[model samples]
Target: MTHSQKHIIGLVFYPGMTSLDIVGPQQVFSALPGVQIHRIWKTLDPIKTDDGMIVLPDTTFENCPSLDVVCIGGGLKQQAIVDDPEVLEFFQKQGKTAKFITSVCGGSEFLAKAGLLEGYRAATHWAMRQQLMSHLGVEVGTERVVVDRNRITGGGVTAGIDFGLTIASILYGEDTAKIIQLLLEYNPAPPFDAGSPEKAGSELVNKAMLFIQEMSDLELASSVA
Candidate 1:
């Protein structure tokens, strides 16, 4: 990266995406120097997240500038995004030259669908990890963030923070990443130690699995309707 060139990042936004998946990384990237962030979509319209929060896109797929990093955040409507030809083509185009191709959660599915993850190892939400390995032939990872060469991926939702910091450290050095971490007060002390399936136990994990399946079914039905 030349000092004259700005570090540009394109964060894909689409309906039904998880807000934190993009926002967390955005917050971390925003604190860095000489970086430009673009919220990109097929259109410049307002996008509604899975949780009903509305976000506006600043750039469209056709008009987005070349990016240093191309990232997508995932959620329940992943199939829809993956099935969209335009989205897949856009990702394919960006992946050709983007220094880093990345995603959080099920967003990696989009890259997989675009044929960008063909030879890379990746990390995604636990819910989608099996499918990526089985269906897409990706070397799915179990870590919070997985970096295979230029493909930097994050685990489900909250791992975006760790993912961002990891990318930051790689781009700007550990000292700079530490400075940004301190500025953001990036400390984690959750009230419960139930962040993972193993810790949450079978009961909670089963319930969560059931709920996620039900939601997926409903969303699939709704999309068709």
Candidate 2:
């Protein structure tokens, strides 16, 4: 595929977003020599991550084209859902035009509020799985990544790479995905065995629960506003 036909992929950056969730897949997808990838934000100015890293986006929300593919990642500032009408409107508009729409962790909530995930099977970080169901009223499953039609969803931070590869497989073909996985040397071996929610136990799960609780009001307000 030529550069123009490769697909325009956009990642929307927000405050408190999981750096890995957005960047990891971005790294993998952008590596496709043909794809044109960009980081977009509410503004074209440089934005900072929760960890104090600043990133300059390729474009602002007002000007970004109707993308071929777009991914939203979780962040601390989800209040934008209700607090920023422009963000919600932008998401709704993009969801309609984009060929594929996906999210990581809490990002799915935003999509749901925009009325994109209704009647679709989805997934999110182990922490937000239940919240996604309760708030969005969508049937969600437990998986590292779930691909249902054009809407792809995944668990937490590390899940982005898997999500990207999965989407690449669907869009470009299984062969292309395998080639990228091999080239990226993505053989993962972990010392801890806590990738699944069943094994994380209540304590670790509660910590994540508390964190989401703090953001709960934001989502509620966003949904209403």
Candidate 3:
């Protein structure tokens, strides 16, 4: 397909993925004209989200067409994916030809596991940033969205919107991204000032860190077993 007609975006969907990480970006890209979004998985079966939502995959890894961009979203099952050779292979193969390889939240963990994030600066959930650096040996950035060459990663769950808009600007233009942002009514006025660890204060940050620690322990166990 010609450059003008090519706007294929493949989003990897797997069991236990954070729905918002995928859906947030999905909505933004879906709003753009001529952008074809594909929900890809190992099979066309329905995959359950972390919140117990059922998401049906539209394309299987074996049958997926060439994509301009490939994205994966973070969730609790990242360790499972990291240990799955088939999943890593799929990402490794796609990263070879995809114009852009990106992830949101802990999804960058999968990319690092697949050896796709090596030598590229990436971003992930703040809680998992240390683990990402310690385990993957990748340069981690604390930004909402990080772009190193064609590897783009977004921090945390909500950062997916920012990541999507950034990609939108790259593919379409800043004007198109602004139009999509307006259509989504993407203005933010969070009621609480607890979005980040710095703003959340020590008590809340400690609680969140405990949960992250537990998850990291489980991930470590799973990875070695």
Which candidate should be chosen as best, given lDDT against the real structure? 1
- The 0-to-1 C-alpha lDDT of every candidate, in the order given, reads 0.91, 0.80, 0.89
Clashes of 3: 0
Which ranges of candidate 3 are over 4 A from the true structure? 1-3, 212-225
**Residue-level lDDT tens digits of model 1 in 106-142:** 8999999999998999999988888999998999998
Note the clash tally of each candidate.
Answer: 0, 5, 0
Query: Candidate 2 — what's its lDDT?
Result: 0.80
Q: In angstroms, give how far residue 158 of model 2 lies from its true place.
A: 0.6
- State the displacement of the C-alpha of residue 113, model 1, in Å, after optimal TM-score superposition: 1.0
User: TM-score for each prediction?
Assistant: 0.95, 0.87, 0.92
Which pairs clash in model 2? 16-75, 16-76, 17-75, 81-222, 82-222
List, residue by residue over 154-196, the lDDT tens digit for candidate 2.
Answer: 7778888899899888778788788889988998997887677
State residue 67's C-alpha deviation in candidate 2, in Å.
Answer: 0.7
Consecutive 10-residue window with the lowest summed lDDT within model 1: 1-10
Candidate 1 stretches with Cα past 4 Å from truth are 1-5
Question: Cα-based RMSD of the predictions, in order?
Answer: 2.0, 4.1, 3.3
Candidate 2 RMSD to the real structure: 4.1
Off by over 4 Å in 2: 1-4, 80-83, 207-225
